[model samples]
Target: MNQSAGAAQHTHRYSVEEKIIGLFLRTITQVCSAFIRTAAAAALWSSRLQMLSEQSNFSDDENVPGSSWHTFSLQFGVWKDIGPVGPDRNWKGIGISLLVILVVLSFIGLSIVLLSKDTGSKTSGSPLTLDDLFQRSFQIHDPDAKWISAKEIIFQRWDGNVFKMDMNNNKTELLLKNTTFATFKASKFAISPDLNFVLLGYDVKQVHRHSFLASYLIYNLYTREVQELNPPEVSNSALQFASWGVQGQQLIYIFENNIYYKANVQSSSWRLTSSGQDGVVFNGITDWLYEMEVLHHQAAHWWSPDGSRLAYLTINDSLVPTMFLPRFTGSLYPRGTEYRYPKMGQNNPAVGLHVITLDGSSFTEEIKPPDGFHTRELYITMVKWVAQEKLSVRWVNRAQNMSVLSLCDTTAGSCITKHVMVSDKWLDGQNEKPVFSRDSTAFFTIMPLKHSSHGAFNHIAMISNHSSGKDVSLHHLTSGTWDVTHILSYDESTNSVFFLSTEEGPSQQHLYRVSVMDSSDKECLSCSLFRSNCTYYDAALSSDCQHVLLNCRGPGLPQTTLHKLSSMREFQTLDESAELRAALKNRRVPKTERRTVQINSFAFRLELILPMDLDETQKHPLLLVLYVFFFKFSATIPPS
Candidate 1:
């Protein structure tokens, strides 16, 4: 929907009665606040006057203490210090008394007004409508926090300014001002490894689910300068993809289907590949089939840890059938565009893994698949750099029934299978990247393990002797009925692997830290915090493993908080959704109930959201939507 349509749907006009009630409540609230402030001021003045009176107590014959004003001793000074003459004696005391009376009167008035409006305040507010839900009236505000380093975090404000916050001092400094590049709105940013330069992409035109064409620009944080990120051959043009390298200000981008590189923000661009076709062959980026079915990511490139080599996939879809989509705008007759989309029993795109050294000259070396696998029938599911010269890649067959994890030498472009997994049923499309040991001899990945009679649950297991090209032994690091959802981080300093799991329940996810040396030594980091409303959670750890950003995606309102790892204490609250909570306080929202239903040997969770005034005794229409595949896959993965 367009912006105007969205705004119109969220807008609501208040009824006459509602407007009147709202006006009355606002007026009463304002009056009560004013009265309270006035009463406080009056009480303060009365106390100060009493103190002055007590301090001004001086004997009339003592010529009054500090009596430099005795020169004006026309009886006025004596009268002023003492009291008024005649029936008006003790005038200062009387003034203090009047001030006290004023304070008491103000308090009494405020109390009466509050008491009078108590009944009105007790009335239930307006009923919640579909408009509220559509408008996301209760959605919490997130600060969009990202960790730039162990001791610092970068977050964007609502006004588009990015800020850097130091964890030690809790001080925030402006990193990027929105006004600096006000020419266009950037949809995303890629910060350099040094955190000195930011690559911004604007004028984004989405091509697929995760791919887009955007014009890129570079902003220097130190100099506060902005420059277009166009290659020398191309000026003011949109790029297919762009990102920073792992070291310094080195960067890479894809223009006209070809890969380009820059040593720094101010350096000239170099074309890395020349055999890129618009729809046939993709060099650094993925095509529709690879992006949607295999990798599930836009880019197929992986930079080495030292930024010395690049590993990317080349997908050729010339033999694949084309799918045409019609465009319905800018013409009387609709014009259509063609996309290479492979269907059942159709030719799949042939994929090849290639490695290129980035030391000035470039000659791409193709990394062949393992034995018994052909490049035409294989899919590269995951690519990760293990060391400066070693790369790990997972390849699955076209049927997705067999997967092979291999380690490749970047210098030779040769690979050897480290582990092989075969299943009678379809395997998980893309497995998570295995966290490798520092020495690259061992690694950790999630595999299904049988626990008692609960079938097989996904657990973390360490595989050793991977580098020896021998049969690796798997040792369980975590074993339970609950599934480990993700491997978040591995802290070498603490020898701890942090992960998220459904230990609390099927609907809940919590962060956990487990020792690699001792699997039995495990602790739940986020379980004790927010036990009331928060259930589902996700986390992002800093590189040094000193801090984490815990996201509470909840049964109640979601919140994001930064926490210190050592103490497990909250360091900062990125967002608590205070405004959203206030907006929902008086709303008559729907009631929800959760229940577990046991059918034969399987237990299924059921959640029902009912109307606020629902009548259980009466028959009501039911709208039931079932996600069979998702539920079954999550329940358990039966072993082959």
Candidate 2:
């Protein structure tokens, strides 16, 4: 009876959003599959390491005194295949002793694995649920810009369709529709900093069996042309548009650990800055964790607004210990993938800052840290050149308690550590990157502010029986319950600061553009520039601040659309497909709506999206897990 109920529940869940659910289930399954593949790879590599060591032993050229440099070979005796004392069966004492020792060692190894760590700790595991992906404020900023473009994952669908919606003007154009191939779904994309070109990538099969593939396509807006940037013959995809070299003339992308560069508008040569191998100087780029987590960027290097010399990260990984993903095989040997990841309490990769001079042979300067904290405790995520000779660098300490923001003079090779930001929680989870003012005068940090007025439990002291104290500042930013959204860019021209905030309340993203009086006062002017009444809004600003793009989703909209912020007018409406839209138009159905929910003394925007088949009898399981570097809950029903 219980089995039947469970099956019914599972079936009901399928009705929710089969497309998204299938993707989730597939994503989850791939985790375990990848884990096994990694295990197998580690095993094979272990054998290769042993073989290489043995070959070195054989090839060793040992020089003996009073003798010419000649190859030396070691000759050792071993028990023969023939029997021992009498005729056939030989009782070798060493073989029995080896067996006993192996048994003892195997027992000890098993015990250590079982007792030292919990088996559940191996996998990162699926976060809370589908809805959670959108709830957290991971990539939020001050005074959210009007969005220029967007990429939204739809439910009940497999193929990733990318639509470029121009909010405020109301023109929804399809850039890349869904593909028939499931594995070739468009996963990531980037527009040239010049806004002239676009790059799209899809995850596919890798060159080796254990590797995964990433492919790219470059779209030119002026020429209305489309071309594949990567060579068709190679097995690689994980490609990205690192940064625009000035007029979008040069392109930078990463394939595995290697950084590739290509010039635009001609038959140009591809230059390799990184070669996947360690100990190489990386030009115009950052590493995986820094890109994936910290700076909220995929490109390691950044071209100045002028696109002159590039400011980027150069990782020195000669110290970090590599942890291999282990794969188990049912066959004679297991196949797998490999990478070097620094485990907790282990030596991490040494990070440094580098400035690449594009005028000639690139010159490099190492922004080495002063040896005070242990080397393993430092993590660098973002670095930007403040001027032709000045650089801004941020590093999170090992304890994650405080991150010291520093300015480096590339001219003198000097570093002046400035701001010290410590987490009020006292424990650092994944932290966000700092945003610099355009002039590079001051930096911004979006931290949590505890609310003492509500009398809620606050501090998570690193001790047993932690005190449930009220919200208060102890060398912190604020003393109330508020988490800072990301620190958006500063507009020096107007002395206006932009960022997203839950200062009103969480669950909704509101635009807050604060006008600063001076460095001392730091007071916000009452005359506001713009505000959004919705939960999810992404914005981009023009240099003059006259034009702003706001991508928003209000109540009842499954897909997000665009809007112009200043006028708060509809720019473009994003739809699923032409056919679907026509079919829906044929039916006289009620249009969806966005509600103004009161939150934090402010009316917050909340939009709703529902299934086409709105039968009350129909039930779909809702998954609400927040995504990394984001602050919204996205829901997707899994396939049964």
Candidate 3:
């Protein structure tokens, strides 16, 4: 019985030893599996990190995703929580740890590289500076601003080459090349009436408000020849005025204040006036006062529509008071320049309206002013040839309160007043040239309506040119609350008047066509017909009224466009400021807002400009701009 008990105890001990061995083997297996899993995961993560790093180096996209260092750290922490396997079996764990560390390092390197690249990209395209802003703020003129001939726009480029662009297809062709003439370059140019010659002004020096002294050149289109327009007596004297006559290649110029004429390129120049004296008398050209206030033109001359006669103003400023202007340039002592400038209630230059025949008949006749006015102070505001033998002259009193429109019979040398308009305020209608009817029996002018809702808004009126007294009947043509800002043209074909008005709004100007036969028939041509981006507008109509050059001035970017009148479709964009817009695409710009405030009986219009990215929570300084008439106010805000 004792031997049996010993064998049983031995068996129990063996059983316990076997169970412990089995338990160790199972634990070892589990550790090996965990190590294998950790190693596999590290390899996978390492490969992924390497792939992501390579992609980041060459990838164009910035939103690519990769294993972050935090995520790797969290994963590594979880793996570490599993604890290192037994030291005898921890080799796989160590290798996995090394791989994970390499992946983390790679991720850090790639992240730094990506951040640097982003910073470099941001630093490359810098913001615009003050100098850049000023440089780009210059006005870019619409090439077709001044001269458009025969459906073609003519302009001179900076290189002094003249080009003509066809409005039909926007095709341009070189018309004249630069011709050097004695150290002078062509600075201004105008085409002839027949488009056969280009009159060029070189070495131009501005003298007064509207007058310039320049040497002249005549460029022949057919022969491609350039000729100097120098008078025989003077070698290089600057001409006061050089312009094309109404006839084909006929030229008229003023030298030293005297008028000279040329029938053609090969013809000799003849002196038309010999009474011109420096600072005393000016013939065929305005003095400083007339240029500044009355005519606003350099030449005070008019050519007959048939090109048969020339009407000019002979201004005598001998008795007018002299004003001195100081000139400060490259000199220790400033020199005072004396000019005849008449102030209010002072004696003005005596202006006379004279008509001279261009047919070699030295017959010059003067149209006397009216019955009761001092000739010395009476100002001849406008002179336009209405017919071959008749001319329209406007005379305003020295006080500028009363105006008299007279029709002068050039053949009879007699002037008769047709209408006398008296205004309590200053009369502004003297600058408007009346549009005569086809038969010259009536003329159209913008006159204040007797009864209107808008309080003395100017409207088109047809007045008889036959009446000899102030009782002439005036027929109202266009009656509305808005004022007709300007009369563009009188279409004889349609018996309609084309004008620009503030009919749309005070801030906006649009073209309108109104019929004289039916005063109620009017059409707004440009109100609803822009590219949804333009607000203010100005237009230049073709001679035949078949096409119009529309200038879209902005609340946005300004652009010039050509359109067909018949179809009202955009032909082409002449100047869109594409380069300027492109440069400003990524730059900050100021925001503008317009509002009108009514204070008592006065309504004041104001425009505000706010800085870019303006925050309402922050305080901003304000600026108030005021002008004499306060017609428009524009503000600019700098970037923060």
Candidate 4:
């Protein structure tokens, strides 16, 4: 009973015609979801990330050799602004000549000050590592929308030499005692759709690289006890996808292209839905090429919000052309890493999207298509069941010139479409997140208004699928130039969307709130949430929608702080470890002194840094000066 390969596909490859139709459906769905998701998960991570501080660095400048270029520039900018601009742009005029002469003298004085100043940007010593970096980069008092998420607060510290922090009585405590490393590591995590727990992780080297079972430890989080969610024996595969359900414990992850599910989080038993290892048929995981170039993930998959079925993009890369590049390690011969890659306007994976039931029984629906579509592998931005049987998936076209949002009717197994968005240039398709309202009648999407090259000025479009016997149209949200840094929060309970915008000035961010409404444009009823921004960072709202934990930077100190933002913006700084505090206190405190100098042909403003530890205030030896990048640096005191 071996059927022909062509005869076996209940869901065949999509023709260009089918892809067009799908594009239409997804666009409408995206607009509708954008309206809903705009409110649904807006507050998802913000409640957990809240940190802001008002502290001061010992000195804003340091005139020391090998100081960072940024620090020197900071000092230089301050010194130059000390004088006003010259005589209203008239240099040859009488009053202008005096202004010019005086300005020139001032410049010379500034250069002299720089030459004599002891300014240093960085000390590179072990104790003053990231803390110093944070303080400088983050300024919570006048922040550019900075945020820090103190992810895990554990009882017992995590081993493996990783930096750890713990929460103890309204303050964060450094728990990993007696360890040489004093800082935490960057987290690679995927939060579950259920929003109950976050799936923290490692790369392929830790998981499936050797054997799948051996690398299963990554699935479990917080045995050390900060926030624990119960889930059955679910092992995160190497180089794959995993997510939570809307209800918290339900989980889905890809294993060998096959999609698997565990209903209860605490159980170890699982059942397979697709026999994806057949190598030809892909289930939940994306093939290497699609995951790498287009999707930005090694896996091409997603979880439906309600968490009933898993919708995934499958790639049939068997026909794609492969190119080989030689790896020469200065040897006579070289080996190569062989794989499939799509060149500009070239062959790509035959893209297809499908929905599978959680029971491993059958496909809830398979999108049928024509042969003109490039169906080998498709770039699926996201998929969700907007309503009971209507699912939406955003699909990008092969040329990368346009993206098509498709809405599929699960029960009918067909899709009525709309061409939501079309771009003539490259764009960040992932930014096209589809948000749905609680009732699932309408949604919204924020997409590029012009071409991708000018995305900093993109427009937010609100599309509706309500039908209502009228023209379901698209509405624009932004009036002027603004780029979104983070959709900090969306509260359906309160009917508002909180997002960070750069409309104030380029490179600086501010928090803004917009009301969500119905067809009449009346305000929607939701939560009464507050907002706060001390410095520039991103944040995520917690599940309760009341808490926010973030990394905030002040004048000289950037630390993690937790805030109960929904009710009030109160500062709760994490406590520092005694050892770390002691180390910092004992380190050389560099004080910046302003000076001017004339070095070569350039008049410069300099920052002089003198060590504070010396008993004799003015007397010191070896005021060695070093010039780098044409900027002179010196220290009034030498290292002991």
Question: What is the RMSD, in Å, between candidate 4 and the native fold over all Cα?
Answer: 26.4
CA-RMSD of model 2 = 34.1
lDDT of 2 by residue, 406-458 (tens): 67777567777655556644434334445555445455554443455653322
lDDT of 3: 0.73
What lDDT score is found at residue 485 in candidate 2? 55
lDDT of 4 at 512: 53
Q: Which lDDT value does model 3 have at 419?
A: 79
TM-score of each: 0.73, 0.52, 0.71, 0.53
Q: What does the lDDT come to for candidate 2?
A: 0.48
Candidate 2, superposed: residue stretches over 4 Å from native: 1-212, 216-246, 270-275, 278-297, 316-319, 322-339, 370-375, 385-389, 423-439, 448-450, 453-480, 491-494, 518-534, 553-565, 569-640
Q: Would you list the C-alpha lDDT of every candidate in the order shown? A: 0.77, 0.48, 0.73, 0.47
User: Model 4, poorest ten-residue lDDT window?
Assistant: 47-56
Best by TM-score: 1
Error (Å) of candidate 2 at residue 162 is 9.4
Model 3: per-residue lDDT, tens digit, 1-640?
1122222333222234345555555665566556567777776666545544544454443333542221122363352222221112235555776775566556556555555453343334545567766664333444544445648776544344667778767788887666642234676777887778877788889886578898887877788687889887977778999888877877899987899988877899989999999989999998888887789888899999777788999999998998887767879999878888777777889888888888888789888889877888688888888888989888888888998988889987897887789989888767788888767677888888855444787888888645454446678877767788788878889988888888877777788889988988999888757655676778888877778877888666778777787767656666776767767655555545555666688777766565444454444455545431102345544334
Candidate 3 Cα RMSD (Å):
21.7
For candidate 1, list the clashing residue pairs, or say none: none
lDDT score of residue 420 within candidate 2: 56
Q: What is the lDDT of residue 511 in candidate 2?
A: 53
